[model samples]
Target: MKETFEQLGKKGLIDILVVIDDSGSMTEEQKNLSTKMNSLLTSLKDTNWQIGIVTTTVQASDKCILTLVKSTDTDAEAKFAKAVQAGLSGSGNEEGIRQAVNGLKCSQSPWVRADSSVAVLIVSDEDNCSSRGADCPNSPGKTISYLTNYIEQTLAREIGKTAGIYGIFSPTVNSCKTAGNIGYQYEELMTYAAQKSGTTVSKIFGNICDADYSNTLNAISSNIALLLKNQFELSSAPDSGSLKLSVEGSVIPAANYKFSGKTITFNAGKEPANGKVLTAEYNVGAVPLFTKVTLKNTPAADTISVKVGSTVLAASAYTVSGNEITFKTQPASLAKIAVDYRVAAALKNAFQLEKTPIAGSLKVLVDGKAASGMTYDAAANQVVLNPAPLDGLAIELNYNYRTGPQLSYQVAIVQGAKNVKLYDGAKELSYT
Candidate 1:
């Protein structure tokens, strides 16, 4: 069945709040963002876009980095770059969502337009948890659901406009070297915002580890354009290449429109007449990269989390088959596909003693049973089991040893001695 879209009254009005992490580790990332921000500006040139910058900190006074930069401003690009180059002196615990909500709460700036669509660009290498040690006590919670609600109900509803979230952070289940932690929650919110606002995941998220932001900025720009122009929100995200756009039984040329993940926008002058019915037919599914991925070990259902690049796929996106998972739509070729799950910890057989044991006082027990063939090497002061116990077996060691200062003496013995004689300086002791 073809899905239809009705044009909204608001046109091309977008307020982008860029929330940056100013932690010490974010130095290079900030520079990269500054250098590549122009790409986003160039893409949104046709829209009435305004940019606001804020650091991810609870202190409201110190939050606003750039108050306002409208699309028509002569030096908007430079202003945005300078603002995004938020110095690396802010909190390491980046509560990006909390800062975003606070930004929306700012009454002094008056930058957010009531009718404008909202897009929050979260530039951080950490999760909302502020894992590094910053406390976001003002936030409702550190979960994706709470953050999503803050973005939609608290921010978007307050402005009475459609909203979306974008990110430049780790795009995996686990953190990479550059990022403090994976942007799992931010990414989840990005997917939620994209699906709700008729945009694609790619358009709403970027990788912090990447050296350039050109492509990500372009995607964001295209999505903003979709919001600015008369567009239709598709019921399902479609493979852009397979999408077909038609108006009143007339096929629209590819150049006449742009198909984002779940939305289609007609170029400025190419919009169909008001009364015409626009119809779209497209196969629905993310483009395939690799249909199947084999996991190294069996994964618990509750612990399984899969990510294709920086986009965290919904649980419905893939199905688990044994230890292997098959995605309904494959991931991008170059993009990293990470599958995280819980496995049993490796069995441990050797254990260190708290103190050196008396020559024969050490005893070993495995699973409450006396263990045999166990030996203790005093030099190493550890207990070693010749045959290790099975996985999940508990091991217990019992030993008694002196715990005070230890001393040793070196002495040389003359040629042949019937009985060694020891002396303590003035007093001599004889052994028979």
Candidate 2:
């Protein structure tokens, strides 16, 4: 089964991406998110919160304003407080959620953690037309459930699994009014997505036109607090039996931990204590390991042994075939090519020069003697001597010639024992 893993058994970051509609009608609503920022921060005061915001204006660089990072004194207050007031002309038909996902792909925030739970918050008063489709005037557009599923599926395909989708929109029919955009058909995706995330429709979806946003903001923050759980998923799957966990300096019993599928969860009372470091140790290597090797002949089954550098490995760990070594399960980490074969005939010439061009400064030596009366076609990159030298005669040609296709890693001299020599035309290369 595919599972997300952490390096050295360490967990990833906790990231939250927010999408705000900057339409003229959303002025007070956008300001509300900033005014209640403290409430959102207070809800997640326990962990490192990576928060970012983007507009639904369909701008090129709408992924985020990185300067608006929370929990830091780096001007996030100014940036986040007045983001919607930046005069970015937003499209009246705002596609906040869709635009947020698109912005994440184009201009990703640096704080986004690979192994973190991602939640997208859309603050809009319109229905979602994020997915490309035909006009919705004649026919009823896709329902909120279909759109929410599409969004989660996209997130799962792009950014691992998602925890929740929190949206603040006019969920009730005709509960709010917008100029020209009458009725509440605008943003039903909010309620649909809230339901898709296992949240009650009334719990996460908020009324867009509410004056005091304490209730809606509280709901959004509560769901975000629940979604942003600190759980480390192993980057590489490990043998469950070989796993051990610890909190601070105390080793925890296996009974305190619940391991199933590709992720491990701590028992209710066994969760990591506050300010305490939780670490795990396990043997991992879910992916097959491939290595380039050289064999004097066909590798014999009886004499095969696995050794990396000077470290002898378990005999049952690996298999050898001709020039390839495959490991059934790799270790916790892999380094550079450390098992290079000392017997490898390295720095050996591979291919012979088929055509060498001659020029004024070009020099040619045949059988260690200077040869003359040669004709060369510089444009064709080919040279011809008055009489071709015999096969046994040593030929040295120096000229500026056009390079050919890249050389392959493996080259075979099928019949000849003579070593091929490669030269830069000015000097010898890896081979002389």
Best by TM-score: 2
Candidate 2 yields a Cα-based lDDT of 0.56
TM-score of each: 0.48, 0.53
Q: Identify the candidate with maximal lDDT.
A: 1
What's the residue-level lDDT of 138 in candidate 1? 50
lDDT of 2 by residue, 1-432 (tens): 233223222122446667777766776777777676666555665555666777766554444443346655576566667763534367765655456555445455455544456666667765554322122332222334333444456445221234556666755554567522322433455455555566665666666677776777677666666654445555555664667777655777988766654456654556665556666777765444444444555543444555664576675666776656666665444543344333333222222446554236566687888866665655565455766664446767775554786554455566766766656687876832
lDDT of 1 by residue, 11-91 (tens): 356788888888888888889888776677655654567888888765745344345778778897788888888788887
Give the CA lDDT, 0 to 100, for residue 415 in model 2: 77
lDDT of 1: 0.72
- The weakest ten consecutive residues by lDDT in model 2 span 131-140
